[model samples]
Target chain A: MSRLELRHMRKAFGGLEVLADISLRVDAGEFVSILGPSGAGKSTLFQLLTGAEHGEGEMFFDGAPLDDHGRHFAFMPQRDALMPWRRILDNTTLGLEVQGLGRKAARTRVAPLFAEFGLAGFERHFPAQLSGGMRQRAALLRTVVQERDMLLLDEPFGALDALTRAAMQRWLEQMWRHHRWTALLITHDVREAVFLSDRIYVLSARPARVVREIQVPLPRPRDPTSAATRQAGVLEAEILDILLNLQPTKGHDHD
Target chain B: MASSSFNPRQLAGFLAQAAPAVISIGLVLVAWELYANHSGIKPTVLPAPSRVFEQAMLNRDALLDNAIPTIRATLIGFACSLSAAFALSMLVDFFQPLRRALFPVFIVSQTLPLVAIAPLVVLWFGFGLTPKIMLVALVTFFPMLVALVQGYEATEVEIGQMLRAMGAGRWRVFILARLPSALPYFFAGLRISITYAVVGAIFAEYAGAAKGLGIYMLNAKNNFRPDLVLAAVGVSAALTLVLFGLTVVLQRLAMPWERAAGRRAARKGPQA
Candidate 1:
């Protein structure tokens, strides 16, 4: 189990700041989500968290400062980013292979997860042969195989169709319940944040700062037909209202 | 997968596809022979196709002797060029400053005329196999080098970033992503370079050689035997065709995914 804390994180590119005073926390075995406007520098926050880009911040894991970011967290970027030349099995084993694992051993470990990930018969198929949903599932498998303490998922379902995205969200929650790895998801989908997360962080537009943090009291297995689902809807509306109210101030900030 | 017998329908379809080109060549040959016999043109100027074939058959032993040196020189030179280009491209890709400094030099080297340089190479290296090999390597290196470097550069940036996020190093990113992505470009360069290899070898030999098709052509030209010269030309053309076909086969074997994707595209319109 691992806990992550970010305190007063700030990042800029050249003269333009993208993340301003953004702070959040993820307790051990918790699922947290970040919701924001379309161009609110959510990706910059991810880059900072993963050490892909540098930022000014205090980041702690398990009560100790994290000098390095990527070593302890598995990251899934917005795009599936599967290597077209590699087979699905090989692609799924990429993270492990990067960590100095042998090819044969990595293959052995990843070969069984194909069926769990809904990719049983496609071990030999290339990325171009799979549909978008399958590619995302393969990418997810690649991320999970690394066995990191935390997972950084950046808009993992942003490109999926609505129906497929909803299905994948349910499937993801089931996997999260089983594995219970600490996860921080960056997304603009309020309903997705409300449905999957134990807590949600909402950010304002560019040079984003955390405007609100909401605890979701909804129960697990949040079936859309349950009272919990109705509660999620109310919470989504409240978050939407906060974002709508923030828009005028966001425009003035830009000025 | 190995079968002694082919599907008869498949065989018939292939024959049907090739029939027109075969017929056209046959007709041109017959017409050339007839015109040459009727018009009483000098064989030294434009030998009839039948006379050229007969000359080739009569001097088969002599033709084979010279063909050996040309073939040897061409294969050795092409192999050298391919290795050099691959090493140079990989080095340039690994070192950013080297790319800026060396790529322009490679491009500039290609603009020099082979005709002017071939003789100078022969003068420096003498009438041995060294000059012929050097000429061939010089002429065929550029296309492959450009293709390989551009292929390396064209690696999908998002994939590289994702790998980096997963803790992959610079060399690991190159091995797992850039190398595989560059294969198609490498084959494209190979096809372009192959057509030049034989011609470069012949030019090298033309400048100076103890034995080769180029020397045979020169001897025939001096003796005023245009038929023999045409026969040597025919042999070199055949050699080029064989090499080109080999590269295509290599491409097919190296990229089975491309073939599968192509078949899928054909079945379902274009992939988005």
Candidate 2:
């Protein structure tokens, strides 16, 4: 059975529909990427999946329907979104802290992860002290530390420079493989979608629908610079063409 | 770069910035002294700074005797104002309807000139500490309320979403996210309110009081003791400076991050 199922999910902001009749199933430990252009409702779909907004949908997690009071997924937004006042360690352990875990216990659990993530000495440093790449790593650590089966990431590496972004993608893939997590990533970068995802769901413009789902048959332990990885580049171009065609006319576009 | 050598240019720059204010104050004091001598102004009419200092020395015991009561009142009034304003701000933040209903009333209360209302407060509460404390709370509350509301409202949507995604409740979000972000605003409001606290207490004392700087000024006026009045004025100015200085100290302690940013800016020198 799939770990997460979104059946006919629909979301509208007043008269404007953002996600329309989107249905998909994510199996346990599957990595899926929702790719589209800007304002293509990829983030909106992530929001809907994670219950960021109430929408018409049937969402089941681990074969159980998600109730109003229960949470089954950890969500990481496009930005780092770290609490500026909190120390790096405290920020990473916030999810557990909110779950009624004592500070000592939460810190105990997060201590090893800090060393694993290359954040050992900077545990006491606040978010402002960290560089952009480090901040994103801390944010990812925060999401993962919650121990949720499904991780919903919205443009996680979209803000980084090209080199940093590539490094983060490789690091994230390593982390994902190590823990074997089910994740749904939203990104405007088609290459990112193809490289990171096992299967890619391409979303159309606002009032978005999944227009295409491309299965990535790339070999495991995918080397970013290898010729086999260049196959993913071909897939990226095809997705880009679809996204470009989906852009609305000037008069129809509204923020 | 590793050397800890002194920079003569930096010292000169510091002195250059301070020179104007120091010279301006000296000129003002000299002009006052000269005008008093030329006009044959009686010490009773408008005493020179020297005469004011002399009077301050002579009446040192008397000034201290009156100062204790006034200082006590000011401290009590300021404490009352701070607590009341904090609680009211929290209340306004917690409930939307209460905020909508009382915000306008608070604004309207501020517009009702304190000079006009001081006498009424004194009449209602008598010449005790109650009236003075109420007046200080009244004057200091609005700025703090406005500041706090704006600060609470300024919580970033991204941060709020992050907290929500972690399954944190509204109160949890507020306590963790909103409260810390609002610290600078609260400190700013406190700084502004500190000035108002001193003025409000003195104004209330002026309307009806037997002690305080305000009463001392009134007595000096009636007795034609201009030097004593000037001395009292100097004390009031000193009090304001002390309160403002305390705010700066509190802000530094509360927001080390801001101070770090400020130091960085200072090190960077002027930016075009």
Candidate 3:
């Protein structure tokens, strides 16, 4: 069964529609990326999928309709927004603590993952003590430690420098491979989308609609410097052309 | 290596910072002592530092009795103000409409000169600790409340959003994020309020009380013993300093991070 399905999803803010009739599906352990220009409603779609906002749509997780009472999905926001006052370990364990797990149990669960994510010795360090890349890694650890089957990441590496971002992408790919999560990521960087996804969904400008869904034929555990990465580049250029060529609707130039 | 161990330059820098205040106070005492000796100025008109020190020693028992009442009033009033202000701030934060409705009232109350109301408070509550305590609460509550509300509002939006994304509820966000962020603000307000607590207590005592430094000052003034009045004033100044120092200590305890940061900056010295 597919882990998540979004059907005919539509969203509007006042009179401005952000997403229009968007639909997608993710099978278990599949990785999908939504690529678009800045205001292409990529984030709006993530918000909708995570139930952060209400919209006109039908969303199913594990063949079950998304309801207010259900609590199976986790959303990771764009920014590395760890609480400044909390140590990295406490911040990572916050989700489990909220779910009524005691501190000791949550720490035990997070301890091994800290080493896996290269954050073992820094558990007692507060957010201000960590560098930006380390902070993002801690944020990612927090998201993954929730033990959810599906992860919705919105521009997780968008704020990092190019070199750090490249390193993080490879690290993320390894983590995903190890854990086999059904993941959906939103990004404006076409290269990032192509590098990390099994399939890329191209979104038009807001009131966004999915214009194309391109399946990436690149093999798993992909190297960014290889010929396969070059092929993905060609695919990214094609998606870029579609994004740039898209024109504003009549009298809707405010977008 | 020995020269570096006892660098004259570093010793000179430390002394340079301490020189002005120390010299100015020394000059003032010398001038006062000289004028009192040469001008035939009676000790009643202006107590020499020597006389005030002697008086302080002589009347230690009486001073202690009065100090106890003022200290009690200040502490009780400060505690009441902190609790009341924190609770009100939380209430205002939870309900925007209530904040909107009551915020103007809070501002107006603050604008009413506290000195004008201190007498009226004594009239209502009588010339006891009750009036003094009430006056201090009135003076301290508004600043603490304002600081707390602003602190709560100042929580970083991105941080709040991140916690929410983790499926953490409102109370969890507050306990983990909002409360810790507000500690610095709370301590800042407490510092301001601490100074006011002493002043407000003194003002209330001045308006009607039978004892306290304020009452002592009044009696010394009537008796034309300026030296005693100056001595009382010095005690009050000392009390304010003690209270302010207490706040700094509390700040250190509550936020060792700030103290560590301060030490780091000091060690780094001036950046060129």
Candidate 4:
């Protein structure tokens, strides 16, 4: 079992404060989403978590203070970040290869995952050969194949068209239901957060602080077509409202 | 991506694109022939196209003999430079101090006056193959080093970050992201260096060599046989074109993925 707890994490870039007294928890087997407006320092938080950037924070992993870089989370960027030169198969196996697994061994481990990721025939194809949605799936396959403690997906579906985004959202939900990996997703899309998350953390605009945490009680295999799914719409609206109406608390700053 | 299989349609398309270049070259040759026939210039100073052709045919064996050495020097020198660039670039990528020290030196190497250095190189090394090879290596090294450095730096920041986040070490990140991104740049640099490789070797041979196209041209010049000199020049130009074509083919072989991308862009270009 793996759990992540961020306690009073604060970050400043010179004189500009980014993460102002941020704290959140994602228990084991939980699928959490951090919903925020664009430029709300949503990405900066993930950057810190992935050790790409350093900031003042207390990140506890399974009740231990986090120090190791790659032990806890596998990261997926806003873009697919698939190496254009490598075939889709090699791209998916990249994480394993980086983890010191031999190329053949890594390939073998991730071979079956390509089919599950809806990329059966694209193994030999380059990143440019595939469509945007296919590339994202390959990237997701790359992330999950690492078999890390959790996944930190930063705007995974942010680059797709609306129709493709919806389809990928459904596809991702099905995959998540099957594996049940502890995951934290950072996104500006309220609809995406509502559809994919078990719980959503809303953040204010510039100097991001958790304004509220909303639990989505939508049951497993959420029927996007069902009348009961209106509950999701309500939650989507509520989070959207929080995001849309968020005012920069400049007066409360430096307190 | 396996462009190995040929088709009639592709051949037709290629020929269509190649038609203009062939026509332009043919027109230039025809115009030169007409001028040589009418100008009534001394053959020693300006041999007609026909005379140059006749001399080339008659001296084909000698030309071939001289050509082999020049080709060998060019290939060997280019290869040495490539390997050195690869080794040095790896060191530069890893060590900040090495990069800081060597980068300015590399630029200075490019700016060095080869005209003044060539005679000095011959004087030190004697009229053997060593100085010729050295000049060729020195001339070709900098483009590749610059290409490799720029290519490594141009790699997407997120790609490196994502790899490190996956527990990739510095070496792994390099081979995965940095190295591949540098391939296009490397090939572009290679194309530039390769063109100069042939020229550099010839320049070295001209400075001093027992047997080469450069020596052949010098002898022909002193003998008042301008037709022979033109024939040697023609041979060298043909050799350079062949080398340039080979680089393009090598680039294709190295990066089939870029070809795939190009095809996709081509297909989408009209509609988009």
True-contact fraction per candidate equals: 0.52, 0.40, 0.29, 0.70
lDDT of 2 by residue, B7-33 (tens): 888779979998999899999999999
Which model is ahead, 1 or 2, in terms of lDDT? 1
In model 2, where do residues sit more than 4 Å from their true spots?
A: A68-70, A250-255, B1-23, B260-272
Over A1-255, each residue of candidate 3 has an lDDT whose tens digit, in order, gives 788888989999999998988888888889999888898788778767665678998888888888742266676888987876677899899878877899999999999988788787988866666666788889888888887777888899889888888888888888888888889999988888888889888888888888889998888788877778678888878888777677564664432
Reference-based TM-score of each model: 0.90, 0.90, 0.88, 0.94
Docking class of 2: acceptable
Best by DockQ: 4
Candidate 3's TM-score: 0.88
> Which candidate, 3 or 4, has the higher DockQ?
4
Off by over 4 Å in 3: A247-255, B1-54, B259-272
Model 2 chain B, poorest ten-residue lDDT window?
Answer: B263-272
Candidate 3: tens digits of C-alpha lDDT, residues B103-185: 89988888988778988998998988899989889899999999998888889886777666667778888877888888889
Residue A173, candidate 4: Cα error in Å is: 1.4
Q: Chain B TM-score, candidate 3?
A: 0.86
The TM-score of the first chain in every model comes to 0.95, 0.93, 0.94, 0.95
- Relative to the real complex, the DockQ score for model 2 comes to 0.34
Tell me the tens digit of each residue's lDDT in model 4 across B181-255. 999999999889998998898888888889898888888999999999999999999999988898899999999
What are the clash counts of all predictions, listed in order?
0, 0, 0, 0
- Measured by TM-score, the strongest candidate is 4
Query: Predicted chain A of model 1: TM-score relative to the true chain A?
Result: 0.95
| TM-score of model 4 (CA atoms) | 0.94
Chain B structural similarity as TM-score, candidate 1: 0.91
Model 2 CA lDDT for position A60:
81
